[model samples]
Target: MERKHKRLATRRAAGVAGVVFAVLTAAAITLVRTALPGGGDDVTLDAGQRGGLRTALELVPFAGIAFLWFMGALREQGGRAEDRFVATVFLGSGVVFVATLFGAAAAAGTVLGDGTQDSTFGSHFAYALLTTYAMRMAAVFIIATSTIGRRLGALPRPLVAIGYLAGLTLLVAGSGVPWSEMVFPAWALLLSLNILWGRPPAAAPRTAPA
Candidate 1:
């Protein structure tokens, strides 16, 4: 009974962290996109736009921290029955996503510090890292997470399907499609809501190792 209660508490914490991460990330992305559309060096930011960008950059670190908590809690929920290979992928991708997110934010901060808008490389680099590399990592994380959830019977089929679709979209079109980066946070929000309010599924029996 104590064990079950502990698990429930962990689940609640994970759900809350996931929700916080999703909201903060989405808001940061929106603010950054609005202030520095297309990451073009030719674009000049007014005082208000710079303030918004600064606010967005400040939010990134907190979002990353929440994401780490969400990832750790989800892994704990998987327990000893999780496939080692898939779990490694899930963990690796999530860590890389957070690292890249921070790197991108740092680069954007450099761009913001340049009052003359001469840091074209910083602007482009940040944009590429965020939209291309970080998003691809996020895609991998989502795919691995969905696979684990499906194997463990924790996620519904429809939600798993949506995860796959969202993962593929991020993998293939993240850099090329404008505003496609929003998909990751949107999916996170949905997953968090499900974790918080949906009925928990029974765990599937673990398969014997080959």
Candidate 2:
């Protein structure tokens, strides 16, 4: 009973951490899209605003990566599958996400503020967008795919469904809306549900491992 309680406590902590980081990830996405200057009035960002956006945007991907790593770790510790394939995809995309953010930050250092922008400036901006937001989107794709292939339980059914729905919605439509930023938080909510309160493991049979 005590061991079970301790396991539950650990899952709770991991869920909380995942939620916190997911919110951070969402906020950072908002910052990148809305705070930066450039593009049309629809997406305009000034030079200084871009700098600030660059700094904030750089941190978000890492937070998300950490969030995944934490959840995977927790699942492993709790005697879940650990799903090496999922972990590998998560790790690869996460690295690209984080590395690109820092790259943007580095770019911010050299590029001084100005009202107008250069064409090459657009290239760097594109890089940031592709690496950070684009790859985050990819993470959603991977998660959705794995969820479909995995063996899930009844109580957790809604979570997997929500994840698939939200991920697909974001992949298709979320990027267009100004408030598309909320997608990360939605994902975080699903992940937390799966981690903290998903179906309990069935009793182990008396037979030993084959």
Candidate 3:
């Protein structure tokens, strides 16, 4: 009973954390996109846009923290059924993804702090870090998570298929693919909803002994 309660607690934590992480990351991406100059041809930032960029930067840390908690809870959800090799890849990729994301946010913050919107190199570098390295790592994380969940019978087939599709899109598109990054958050949101509301399959009843 105690073990059952613990598992339930972890599942709830994982679900909530995934939802929070997805929302925060999506919000940050939207704000950053809104604040970016048009067509890379201009480098001027209006006050509102500047404020949006700053807000996005501020939200990143909390998002990272929530993601870490989500990762922990997800691993806990796997319990004894987790494959060690896949788990290592999942954990490593997730950590790298967060680090790269933070690095990108920091890069963007530097450009904004210096009051120079015209730093083409700085902006491009930050964008590369985010859509390139960070998203690639995210793809790996998604693939590993989906594989483990499916193997453990924790995730539905539809959700697993979506994960594979999202991972492939991120891997192939990299950056500037028009709403590509949104896939990550969307996948996470769906997975979280499943964990939150969906139940495990019921076991068949055993026959009584004669």
Candidate 4:
């Protein structure tokens, strides 16, 4: 009973954290994309755009925090059945994604300061970190997570397929395509909803006495 209760608590935590992370991340990305589309060097921001950028930057840290909680809760759900190699990839990629995301936010923050040259450079740096590095890490995280879920029979085939598709999109087309980064948060939201509402895996059948 205690174990069952613990699992339920973890599931709830994962669902809540995942939803928060997805919403905050999507909002931040939208704000940033609107403020500095394509990360062009010559782009200029108006007062409203600047305010939006600031709001996006401010939301990033909290989003990162929620992501960490979401990741941790998912790992806990995997429990002892998890493969160490894939789990390592999952944890590493997630941590790196958050780090790169924070780095991008920091770079973007520099744009708010004086100097036109600094703003241009900051925007370029921010986009590079976000689209190139962070998204790639997110891709690996998604792929690894899907692999684990498949092995554990925790995720349906359709959901696993979607994870792979989204991960590949972020890996191959993220930097080349504008707004492709949204795929990561969208995948997270879907996976989180599954965890929240899907039926728990059934227990192994016990052998009858001989």
| TM-score for each predicted model, relative to the true structure | 0.94, 0.63, 0.91, 0.94
lDDT (CA) per prediction: 0.90, 0.55, 0.85, 0.91
Minimal lDDT window, size 10, model 3:
200-209
lDDT comparison, 1 vs 3, better candidate: 1
lDDT of 3 by residue, 83-175 (tens): 899999999999999999999898777556544654655667778888889999999999999999888778899999999999999999987
TM-score of 4: 0.94
How would you encode candidate 2's per-residue C-alpha lDDT over 1-210 as one tens digit per residue?
A: 996676567767767777777767666655654554332222344676666666665666566576666555445442444356665565565455555545554454333334345534743565445444754555464463336334433225556666666666656653355455466566675666676776555422344578
Model 4 / residue 136 / CA error / Å: 0.2
Instruction: Quote the lDDT for 23 in model 4.
Output: 95
lDDT of 1 by residue, 1-210 (tens): 897787788888889999999999999999999898866454467888889989999999999999999999999889878999999999999999999999999888866665554567777888999999999999999999999999988999999999999999999997789899999999999999999998866544557889
Instruction: Report the candidate with higher lDDT, 2 versus 3.
Output: 3
Better of 1 and 3 by TM-score: 1
Report RMSD (Å) for each prediction in the order shown.
2.2, 4.8, 4.5, 3.1
Instruction: Compose the digit string of candidate 4's lDDT tens values, residues 1-210.
Output: 998898889988998899999999999999999988756464577899889999999999999999999999999888877889999999999999999999999999988877488778888999999999999999999999999999989889999999999999999997899999899999999999998999876433445778
- List runs of model 3 lying over 4 Å from the truth: 37-41, 114-118, 201-210
Global local distance difference test of model 3: 0.85
